[model samples]
Target: MSNDRVLNICFHGVGEPQRELEPGEDVYWVTADRFAAILDEVSTWPVPVRLSFDDGNASDVEIGLPALVERGLTAEFFLLAGRLDTPGSVDSAGVAKLRSAGMPIGSHGMAHRSWRGLSAAETTAEFDTARTVLAEAAGAPITTAACPLGRYDRRVLSALRDRGYTRIYTSDRRPARSGAWLQPRYSVRHHDTPASMRSGVLAPAPLPARARALAVGTVKRWR
Candidate 1:
């Protein structure tokens, strides 16, 4: 990694799911052992890495936080405002606990739905109201956001900017510019191991792959 670029590694649910998961969401869940192994591996990287946990799973506070704390690492947690206090989800106490532990809080929107082509009301709920609710939960202002379901387009990006978010995260699977307002992240999946993660993330993408990734991000921004 260069001084200008940093890899953003994001984790979803860790350990067993306490409640029902959204369709296809299970693929993102990694076992407790796997999570620990990957975290241990990533913490040793010579390059810069930014860690974040998305979706507000109860395991975030239960498994994610302790493991991170044990390693003396800190990460940002992006929570779903609508799911707060629900069974199997991170509750109010968990949010406060994470904050107390010195983890930054961000919003993953009100509901875990695609941020593309949303109705006006849906947009308000996801972008505007969600931040308000999540900020209240965090007991601090929420200025960063991640697009729900890794989906976003021109409208989505514009709305987020209009709302004055300082950092906007996306699952674009590419290393991000360190100071860019829009950050792309590589999401860890159930099948991802340290070796695979190293190849997929630390190793540079081929020319064609890099071009494709760039094109995809560009299209997403303008569409």
Candidate 2:
């Protein structure tokens, strides 16, 4: 992927059915499985970003997958092991649907705990358990993780390497660099317009050739 032209955009909470929250109550509260149809209407740019969701929601299979399949688009989901069989978590039927649709689910963590404050052993346990559980559910190698709440340090990185995680996603706004495991992702929210979505994904790099693209993006963000 061309670092400048390509982007990585991901959605959160596309799992099970849930009520929509009141405005201003939450920032990015998309219902877990219902976003697939909504995304169908979105006009993809030439250099599309990788789409992803967090918290393996049941609707991912019921709603999200059909939409993605129709459009020939796909997404990745991060699963929380502790929530797998509990209320509000994606059930066995839901997970099977996701696999059948060809979605790649990764680990979110064992309990959705903050990874930054945990001891090395605690972090390792959390990562390993979630990875194992999600992999078994998805029936594939769960080799990546989106660090819980986007917090990580050297110790967490070490733990990931030891546990054999191959990719790591973060919420950092910076563009990704080559060979960097901490791949940055842009989060979508309720207020973002389609135009704003385009600008956010195509984060312009500073160069003599792309000055106008950068200016247009800045203006779009303020509108």
Candidate 3:
């Protein structure tokens, strides 16, 4: 495995959500059993893997943390600034627990909306205020973010770059260069099995599919 590349696997809520889910959000939640199994499978992979969890879901602290600890793995937990301490979500104390457990934190913005089109104020709220709030909770500076809903355009990317974001994570389902500013990740879905994950994520994507991914990324960067 080369140190120049990595496979970023992102996870969302696991087990039963404590709060009402957003419309179509259920697709991202995987069962605890399946989550563990997938982790076991990924453990055997030879390449370097970067694990991340989005949303400030309580399950992150309740289930996700313990599982990672058991496997001797650490993940970056991107939390929603607005959703922190809300019902069904991870609270400030939960963030503390994750930090104490040696997990790094990143911002998922104030609201869990798409980051494609926005007014200046919305940008400030999402990019500025959210980072401040999340940093306060984490007791550290937040210099990284994952695009909410996996949505971002050229303008959005520029805004993040302007703010000095070290790296941005996207749901592009592809391999990523280790030190790239923009990192593509494969999101775990509700129905995914360990075998399915291996075939879908760990395996090299076919030539046509890789071309499509490259084209899509180019468009997103330039659009």
What is candidate 2's lDDT per residue for 1-223, written digit by digit as tens? Answer: 4544435566755433453433442465554333543364243444435777765555555566776787888888777787787665677777878778788888888876678878767775688777788778788888989886678888878888887888888877555653666778777665555556546555363343345556667534322
Clashes of each: 0, 9, 0
Task: Please give each candidate's TM-score.
Answer: 0.90, 0.78, 0.90
lDDT of 3 by residue, 124-179 (tens): 99999999999999999999999999999999999999999999999999899999
**Which stretches of model 2 miss by more than 4 angstroms?**
1-5, 14-25, 31-43, 177-179, 203-223
TM-score, cand. 2: 0.78
Residue 50 error, candidate 2, Å: 0.7
* Residue 33 displacement in candidate 3 (angstroms): 0.5
For all the candidates, what are their Cα RMSDs to the real structure? 8.0, 5.3, 8.1
Model 3 residue runs over 4 Å out of place are: 1-3, 205-223
Candidate 1 regions with alpha-carbon error over 4 angstroms: 205-223
Query: Against the correct fold, how does model 3 do in TM-score?
Result: 0.90
Residue pairs clashing, model 2: 14-32, 15-32, 15-57, 15-58, 15-59, 16-57, 16-58, 33-59, 33-60
Over 1-223, each residue of candidate 1 has an lDDT whose tens digit, in order, gives 4457788999999999999988899999999999999998888765678999999999999999999999999999999999999999999999999999999999999989999999999999999899999999899999999888899998899989998999999999998998999999999999999998878987673344445668777534421
